[model samples]
Target: MAREIDQAHLLEYTGEFSFDHKLILEFIKTAKPDYDHTDPKTWPLITSAYLNKWLIKPYSGVLMLPPFIAYERSLVDLCVADREDGNVELVREDGVKTVRSRFHHHFPFIYNHNGHKRKFEYMHADHYTSWVFGVTGKVPATRTKGKDTPSASADPFDEILELIQDAQHAHKTDGATSLRAELESAHKDLDESKKRVVAAEAQQKLLDKELTHERRRAEGLVQSKKALKQDLQKAFRGEMEQHTITQKQLERVNRELADTNKLWREATNETIAAEARSKKLEKTLKDRDKDLQVSREQAATLQEQMVKIRNELKKGMEDGGQKRQADSNASSSQKKKVKIQQ
Candidate 1:
């Protein structure tokens, strides 16, 4: 019966849910025990750090975005079930779903639709961290004037049973008078809750301003960083140009040096060949002189033998004289040939 009643209420609420703001405030407190949740200014800083840590991006924008995809918002239908069984999920994830396909980006939708049929006019700030942590984005309002208040419509004993009965006739029984008193008290409490909501909304506006200022300061810092980078690149560009010119000059000088080395090697080889030829010619002249010395010795021996023969044949004077003359001519020719050989 309770489940049926909850399902009926769910039918009436075709859109999202809204939970107590204190739950989120409590979450902030648990997340950062150092910061004071009472201080409105700290919310933005905490939220930014939370966003940066979980989503890999700050609260302002994404880290890297693609150029082809337009920076525009598109509507999507998020469907999920409110579980009651033992199965639960607790993984910390932060990202938008639409861009997860091709870009690998996970930024979320900024504008939260409030009413059942969300139109453009109903754009309001979502009182959420955008981090999915097993809780629905919507739940019933439970805080009033910094105090938790019970709804007048719900019965103290049995919420589902009371909801099943009509609101006008639910209290018309033995506990009717007490129920009326409780109802009146609940109404008074509701007024205080409304006042608290108003105050919280005002405080949220101040927080938004602080967030805006912080974002502007961050943007200024980014701009200054970009300017510094440009200046550094400009400075390095001159050195790079000089380096390129010096490298080219060195290459040209190396080529010239290589050519000089090649010429020197060729000249040295030619000199070696000329020296080898000169050595061979000197060896040939030495061998020729040795041969000429042997021939001179032989010619001297032959002249001595002819003189002996002429003495022996003293009566044959004419023949001996003619032979002597021929021998003298041969000796003179031999001397001339030896001189030419030297």
Candidate 2:
């Protein structure tokens, strides 16, 4: 995922300041030699008055003063100068002397010390100067006059020339700083854009590889579809040939069935003719048997008549014989009588 840009301004101090009240009291005492340090309330009042006089009053035009004072390890937090103006001189020894006088005269309880003591000198001047330069972007001015009092009437042309030089330098430095910041920002954007472009290119490569695989799969499917179509056409042709052969066989079977029916009809007609002839033959045989019985009865009656005729002839013959015998006897008797007479 892409990251969101951080649009917030960079913070100058990333951590909190470690405030040292003891250090602040010491700083106040340095400004006023006899400033009371015993009273618990006195510490806050004196520190408030000192900060108001030196730090707050000078920069009041540009920024608001914080309610509390804090310092870093190196006391850098004590420096709060504006970059646009060179007014840090107001927070130096000159400002401290003014605050001390207020405490000595008006608030004596806070500053109960002798008046004849030597004037107090503010310490950490170099640190304060360096801090001012860092904040204002202005170079520190080198002191050329040491213990020499300047004349009352100074050269106004020289002062005007120095002011012009300072203004020109400040302008050039500001322009350079702005240009540097813009260049750094551009470099950061370029690096982020390069990273995004690389990521997009990798993603495009993966998509291309996936597309190639899909194309191959589609081609394979097309080839398989074509093969299946050819097999289906071959199967359809074979089925058509088989159907034609089956139709021819069915026609031959129909012809055979018709021939068998014709033969069956002829056989049935012959059987009917044979049955009529056998019935006629049986009737003729019955008439011939009746005629044969009549012929046998006539033969028996002729045999009985032949037997009666033979018996009558035999009786006649016997009667004739008897008559002859009687005659012969009479003749023999006549003959015997004639012989005896002789």
Candidate 3:
């Protein structure tokens, strides 16, 4: 099976960068930072600040930031679940309200965090995992109210939640970086592969055309063989007819010699003249046999040429078959790789 890289997974970092593992780790030490009383609240506050920078900006434009914020909100909701002990309390400037009712169940999946309306469901699961695991901390039940004592107290879920947040941010940032690099590499490979595919297609087309030509050539050979067979049959018939005519001529000559011998025997009694006539007939028969031998050699050469053509056609057919099979296998492998990616 062919391996295809997933570009999306390669760059995990995106959005507001809330889930950066490094940021989560650094955040754990501070937990919730103290508000500066000396600075005026209205002086100026950076609304777009993200511990994980990638988590903050959704895209290059204004359209990008909202989705990431939504994801971060979702993680917070998942993390802070309702405990049955009623120990949890929500404090405001007005006063402290203890969580008492079992009916509250859990915090809503959609809630406002840091004045931004964010939803946990919108956040990616990986982001949540990073936030939960990367940052190490404990969530204390109450905040100490004294200058000498630290205001923030460690709780069991604090560090874990922070880690989860950090991991997600780090994952996205690294993911974006890795994705950029990978996309570049994939693009290059894709271009090269496309070139190879084009060449393969061209070669396949040429093979197809050659195979068609070979088929036509094979058909022509078959026709030629049939014509040659007919020609040989005609030659054989002509040879037989000529042999019959020669035999008739030889018989006539013998009959004449017999008549002449009869006359000679009666006139002067001559046997030498009959012996010379018989030797001449034997020489004519030998000359006819030599002509037949030459004809047979010509036929044998024609048969050899026909056999060579047939062999060439057979070899061409086999090569074309193998090439088509290889193409089919390659196509199948490519399909399987695509399926795996899906």
Candidate 4:
């Protein structure tokens, strides 16, 4: 039977399921399922079934049943047949029993159920369909379900199947309407992105032009700086030449001043010698004047002596002549007396 095959697959899958004793215990506590509460070995089977039936089954689409639900139905059928032997020992090729431990490689994005790697393929299929509708601006065809309404006395399994079909039909109809609106909005966003890119390119061109203008200005400034530096060098050379000329002129003036000072000293010495000679000549002239005055006094005394001698000689001659005349008269008188006596 088909049920028997499904059960066999379930058993094999459970045996390979990595045992996580702690995770299973926590799942059992939260879910509070109708299973053995004390035994930790039975936790994986109970928790896996719970997750498949409640979390994964209801939202599954009509076209593709989720892997979790398919696995769970097999487990359920096995339990109904013989619930006692559900827990089986899982072993590796090395003959070492797989202990209760968490699956290390399990993650949110990767769905590794019963040795099959599905990824996030069917999980968000409706969301992907809606996105396609929004982009294309098209509505997908609706999937119709059975119109027969079940009576109150209908089998419980039949009623449950009918409700699941109705729910899938409603989900498809709502998704198509919402997707159309999303597609129109996505088209407008694409137009806005294109406009932004064009504006950015225009702005980039303006920036490049400004950069070129600045480079030209920088070159002009460099030329001006070089010219100014050359002018400064020329001015500095002129100032140095002027300083050399001024130093030479000052040396010439100093030599002239020394020559003038020497001439003035020589002239002063000559004037002093001439004044000494003039004083000596004036003393000689005063001595000569005193000698001439003594000569004139001696000549005047000699003239007075000569005049006195001449007056004495003239007086002596007059006395002598008078005496001679008197003598002659006496002799004549004596001779006359003798003649009278004889």
User: By TM-score, who's the top model here?
Assistant: 4
Q: Which ranges of candidate 3 are over 4 A from the true structure?
A: 1-174, 245-342
Estimated TM-score per prediction? 0.21, 0.23, 0.21, 0.24
Candidate 4 backbone overlaps, count: 3
Q: What lDDT tens digits, residue by residue, belong to model 2 across residues 220-285?
A: 544554565556557656656777647776676556546545544533443343344334434543
Q: Write the per-residue lDDT of candidate 3 for residues 1-342, one digit (tens) a residue.
A: 121111122222222233333453243324423322111110111122332354322221101121111223323333332111121122322342222111121211133122233332222332222221212221212222211211334324323233334434544232334433443444444444443444334333433443344344445544554565566557656665777647776676567556545543432211232233335435544554554455455545544544443444445445656777899999999999999999
lDDT of 3: 0.35
lDDT of 4 at 211: 38
lDDT of each: 0.35, 0.35, 0.35, 0.35
List the candidate 2 regions with Cα displacement exceeding 4 Å. Answer: 1-254, 327-342
lDDT of 1 at 277: 41
lDDT for model 2 comes to 0.35
Query: lDDT tens string, model 4, 1-342?
Result: 011111122211222221244554444445544333222112223234544445323321111121111233333333223111111122433453322111111210122222233332222323222322322333333233222221224223233233334434544233333333443343344333343334333333433433343344345444554565556557656656777647676676556556545544533443443344335445544543444344344444433443433343334334445666788888999999999999
Q: Which whole-number lDDT from 0 to 100 does residue 67 have in model 2?
A: 21
After the best TM-score superposition of candidate 3, give how far the Cα of residue 196 lies from its true spot, in angstroms.
2.4
